[model samples]
Structures are given as C-alpha cells and as structure tokens.
Target: MKKQLLRRIGLLFFLFAFANAKGQSLYEIVFEASDITYKAFLVYFNEQDAYMRIGYTYKGKYNVVDVKYQSVTGQEDGYNYLVMVGSNPRFITNQEKGQSYNPDHFIWVWNDQNPNQLPYVTDDPNFDASHLIQCKSYIEIDPKTMTDSYLRQFFRTDEPEYQALRKMRDASAGAINYNTSDNNSNSGSSSNNNNNNTGSGKSKMHLLLVINTDIGDIGQSCAVDQKAMEVEFREIAKAVGMPFEKYIINGEKFTRDNVERTIKSMQVGNNDVVIFYYSGHGFRWSNQTDKYPQLDMRYSEYTPLTEKTSLPLSAAAKAITDKGGRLNIILSDCCNSDIGRNQMTSTTFMASRSFQGAEIQKLKKLFIDSRGSIMITGSSPGEYSWCNINGGFFTLSFIQALKEEIGYMRTGAPSWEHIAENAVRSTQYKAKNCNGCKPQNPVSAVRVSQR
Candidate 1:
C-alpha cells in the first residue's frame, strides 16, 4: 500500500510538469519614442514550445494576429523586437500548407552584434524546422520565465526590398539634428524676424495641419471632407498664429502646375514653421507593369484622374524641408497615403525623391541631419482614411486643443504635448464610429527633438 501511494504521487507530479511545459503566457510590448508605452494582459497557455506564436491588439480589438512574431528576442534594453514570420496563421488553410511551409516565412536565430559580450545562438538551427506546424497567432511561454531577470532575443529574416527601405528611412531620419537651436529667423523682415527668437532654447512653434479632401468630385472619392478640413485648418492657423492658404485643384484657377509652382516658390527658412495641407484624390500605381498587384487611388472624378498629376507624400515632405526650415510639418489627410504604396509609375514619382527640380538626391538624409521635418499621415497602406461630416473630427479636435494653449494665438506662447494627444484621440474616436471607416492608423515618421 505504501509503495502504491508513492507511485501515485510521483505520477501526479509528472503530469503537472508536463502540462506546465505545454502551456505558455503571451505578452505584448509596444515601443514609442524610446519608451515602452503599452503592455497587454498575459495570454496563458495556448500552444507548445515546439511551435511558437505571438499576438497583439489593434485599435480596441484584441487578438489581432495579422502580424505575428514567430519568435521573440527580448534584449536588456527594453526593446521588444518583433520577428515577423508571415501573415497570421489563422488565415492559412490546409490546402495552402505546402506553400506556407517555405522557410521564407519562418523565424530563425537573431544575429545580434555585441562588442563587449559573447554572441548567443539557439541550441539547434533545425529546432524550428522539426516543430513546423500551423497554429494560431499566440505564443506559449512559461509565465514564471517571463520575469524581468530573463534576457531574451528573437530573430527575423529581412526581405531585400524591406531592408533597403528601412535603411533609407533610418538614414533619412538620422540626417537631422533635433538639438539644433530654433532661434534662427526666416521672415525676411527685421522686425518680424526679431520676433522669431525662441525664448527658452525651444522651438518657437510646432505646426500640425490636417487636410480633408471631401468636396471636389475627386476629393470626395478620396473620402476627404474638404470644407470641414478648410474650416479646421483656418481655425488652427488662427489659433497658432501661422499663415494659411487654400488650393482649389478641380477648378482651372488652381491647376496642378500652379500648385506645384506655388510649392516651389515658398520661402521657408530656419525658425519658420511651414505646413502644407492637401485633401484630395491620391492613389498608387506599380512602377513596373509585371507586378502582380496594383493599387489605385479612386475618386469620383467627372474628369479622369491619373497618377501623374497627383502630389506624392515624399515630394511634398522634401519640398518643405529643403528650404532651410528648422522644422516642417506635412499632415496628409487622404486615404491609403501611407509609405507602402506600389512602385511609382512613369507619370508618378516619389515626392521625397523628386526634390521638385531641386538638386538634392538625399532629401531625407538632409532633413534628418538638419532635423528639419516630420511627416504624419492619417492611415497606413491599403487602409481608407475617413472624414466626419458633422465637423471634421481630426481638424476640429486639433483646433480646440490648440486654442486651449495660451500665448499661441498671441505673440508669446508656451507649447504643450496635449495638442498632439488630443488630435490623435479625436481622429481615433471618429474612425471607430463611422461605418466602412476603420481605425485611423496614424503613423509619425520623424527625426524631431527628443523633448
């Protein structure tokens, strides 16, 4: 009887250990401006060690497994580097398993370079290959092991094009000096230029312009509310003490050539905050005809709209930054205007690269080195940007927030971060309530002052 009791106890202990080994907790770590801003509740035990998965939240919805990190590599410096394996596993069907099994979609060992420490490698490169199986986008890790004491790292294979793009972005961002003085003047008038001094060694102004192209037949197709946007822009400018201009593209009065010419002629210089606002029909097309998919920016146009006449984001950003300005803010409120567009066609070119007849090839690099500008957009690639008819949600919220900031409308003012936060929240709320309008995935690409 004693032997049988001991045997039973041992068997129970083994079962418990086995179950623990099979279950792991899921953790979500979000990084913004060098800090970990958000973390999700731990997801407990949904997969095995042989197979790994990662889950994250999108908007307010939980378990948005669209972008999965097959393996995670957590380093000492609070950077939760995500290793993108492929699209979410739930989207892959059994018949597609053969194609999914390709190593191109797998997460391998991370190649971290450390001058003072020894390099770390996985126990077996083939470990992932052996356990290759389809599972939902959830990673199973022991909760106890996830404590702050453990240092983890993840590896991801980077695509050539993606790597190149990231390199370009990083290079561009690195060119600017965020710590540079904002006291330099560009008004070209001695009295007004004297007024441009930054009292506390900080920027005299921070500008944000949100354009909603909802009016013109083409603009309506882009889903921008032009009138609402204009009202919001005018109000924000009035509050911020920045100059404002309107561009009517559909009418012959303001042709694309005229708009481009006006952009070229602007006299922007250091200490002057310049903002370019556009709300109109915009689309992306492939540089090569052979590409499998092509993205089109469709608007209800009485006249046919082509890519050649449209203003590209890259070009607009570069144009503002090139004029020696300490800071340039380009707020584009158009649908599908994010960075990942199909390659540009002959008629269409990247705004960032065009230089608009300027000789600068490395405009991003120049802006980054000089710390000249930042680009914020309404949505990411393949997403629709919306406008609220009642009142331009993004524009209205931005204006109201700025109005609260004292000294802004007046000659002397103190800037605050509340203005940015309020604008983001207002748009988020609007995106959530509007039908056919997904959450506005606003992306800020900048090399600005850390403060």
Candidate 2:
C-alpha cells in the first residue's frame, strides 16, 4: 500500500486454537505471496494486546515462529491493513523444539479478501520496497473445520505452545495504549452498567437496525454488522443507564418504503437516543451534490436504482433528529464508490473483539452528556468502503474505537472526534491493496447541541 512494501512478512507461522477467552476474538488467515506462504493465527484482545503464531517456508522446510506482537488496525494510506509488528521472535522449528530468542524487525501487514495486501517481515527496519511481496488468495479458515491437510501440520495449541503465548499476552497486559480488537466482549456487566441517567427520568434508546440481509453482495457483511451493532448499542444503552428498544428492517421489510415509514413514524422523546444504522450497499448519483452516500434500499437484485429505491443519509439523520431525541446517531456502513457499482463483498472468515470492562463514566460522557446529532458514513465520496469475511472495516473500527474511548485503561478525554478520525484511518488501513476497491476514508459530521 506504500513505498515500504511487504517482503511476505519474511514468511509468517500461525496457531489454530488461539480461540479461547470470551473477552477475545480469534482468527486464522492463510495467504500466499511471492515464493512464500503464510498460515497465521491471531487471538485479538485489544488493538495492542494480540498474539500471532506464524509458520512459513522460506527456502526449504517449514518453520514456525511465535510472535507476541502489538498491532495497529488502520494506517494513513489508501491501503488498509492489520499491521502486526514484534521483536525477539521465539522459533519452533523442525530441527528443534522451542529455540533461543532471535531478534528481528518482524512485521505482517495484511487485509483479508485480497486488497493490495502483503505480509512483511525482515531484520532490517528500513527494508526496501523491492523486497516487498504481494499476497493473494487470502482466506480465513477454522482449523477445526478446515480440510486442508497441509495447514494441519502448523495447527498446534498444546500445553507448551499455549504457555508460550500466555507469557506473550501477559507481558503486554499492562501497556496503557488501548489498541485492541473490534470484537471486544468485556464492555461491562449489564447489571452494573444500569443506573439513573440524570436522576430526573428514565431515558429510552431506540436502535434502528436497517440492513440488507437479503442482498447477495454485501448481505453477509451486513448480517455480521447487524449482530455486532446490536451487541455494541446494547452496551451503550447499559452504559447510559437507559432502556433500549430495537427495531429490525431487513429481508422483505428492507424496502425504502418500509425504511422511510419506520423512521418517519418512530415515537421519540427528549431524553431518548435514536441510532439509525444502515448496513448494505451505498452509492452516489451523478447529479447528487451531497457529500454523504445514498443507501440502496431496493429489496430485490433486479430492482432499479430509482428515487423511490434510494435514500440519502442526510434525510435519515434529519428525520431522526426531528424527533426531538437527545442524541441522534446515523451510521451508514457501505460504499461511496463507483456509480451504481455494488460494493465488493468477500466470503466469511469468522465473526468479528474488545476491552473487557467498560468505564461507566466514559460512557456517560459520550452517550449521556453529549447531545445533538452524529452522522458517520463508512467512506467519503468516490471512495470504496471495504468489507471482508471478517466485517466492514469502518464499522469494526467504530466499535473498536468506541470501546477504547470508554475503556478504563484508555488515556485522555473521550471525544467523538477521535472516534471519527480513527474510523477513517481504520477504513483506509483495511482497504490498502484491496483487489476490487480503492482507498476508503470515512466521513463524519457532528452537530453538538446544548440542551
């Protein structure tokens, strides 16, 4: 995605059962580039707290390396990548058991579903782009369910291997930086997260999940997004000490008519929060002057992109904002790319991670204290919003960023600006060298209200 390219992570090893811990998210990605191939396993906790086991064949036989790495999910370029960099790799080779430490400037920059992605690793921190290797056929597999005989050789999470990884994870647990997985589960306990909002009245939150679960292209991504948003907003509700009501607009009910009716007819109050989130296809028309993308609400694949079939994000935000809710959040996770071209969707790798416990005060500051409207689209105009088998990059980043902003371990004050900035970077990070699409930079417009 940039001048410093991937030399195939010098060839990376991975582990399979890095899958425990409800507070963590797990994955195994297999990709090939240049003369090297990688079957890498990741157990992600937060942005910085993650582990990797890389097995690769450099010149001859297969070699396995244990990487206790810190990762940054999004970068600044048009390319998006999960950048894992570490030092002092512990090797488990064919010639020996776990060997002595070898210091190397090891790095793996990859995005699933084939972007302009490559895994880089080298002893020289300033390695040139000439050595960079491009990866292809990137796929996420469940080792327990996979049938590949070759990958089975590298799938070891036995006692010794597990212990080594445990040491790696424990070493970084105290690091103050909060860069973890987007699939974080330890947000907070539901019981403790509930309390009085302002000691005046009970607040109600409306979570509108309008998705295109039936669309073939982005349906899977949307479905996964649907689930992730549900869990996240519920955490938000609990954080703000409010009761939330959920409304689903998907499948046959995903028509524009249905979506419009739902938003226009909702009963919202002054203390309420309306989160109108749409996940699926999005586009921009030729004459459209608005920077925000239009949501394609057609129910069938054969349906035409008409005025009746499309809805602008501004309209949705205005509609929800008109209801007099305390805070109105409009999130659109889809493409703002080529005219009428559907966003490229990849196959499923696994569901999407997070911090364990959430800080109630942080949550109150963002959700309860903040007022007015927040509009976030996954991409800016003329850019492609990226999604893989994992999930939509911007959506994942929003949740990841949100978790960090409110996590007890996070430093500094929590602000929506940080979340918006991170979401844009994260989306760009995942889109780097992506096969089908260009760089995606998320756009956010916030109007703070004094109530």
Give a tens-digit lDDT track for model 2, residues 339-403. Answer: 54346644221124224445566677777777888899998888777787666877877877677
Which ranges of candidate 1 are over 4 A from the true structure? Answer: 1-250, 253-255, 286-302, 337-372, 391-393, 400-422
Summarize candidate 1's per-residue lDDT along 118-220 as a digit string, tens digits: 1111112232333322222223232224332221121122323223223333433444211111223121111111122242232233232222233343333
Winner by TM-score: 2
Q: What is the lDDT, from 0 to 100, of the residue 196 in candidate 1?
A: 20
How big is the positional error of residue 255 in model 2, measured in Å on the Cα after superposition? Answer: 1.2
List TM-score per model, in order: 0.38, 0.63
Among the numbered candidates, top lDDT falls to 2
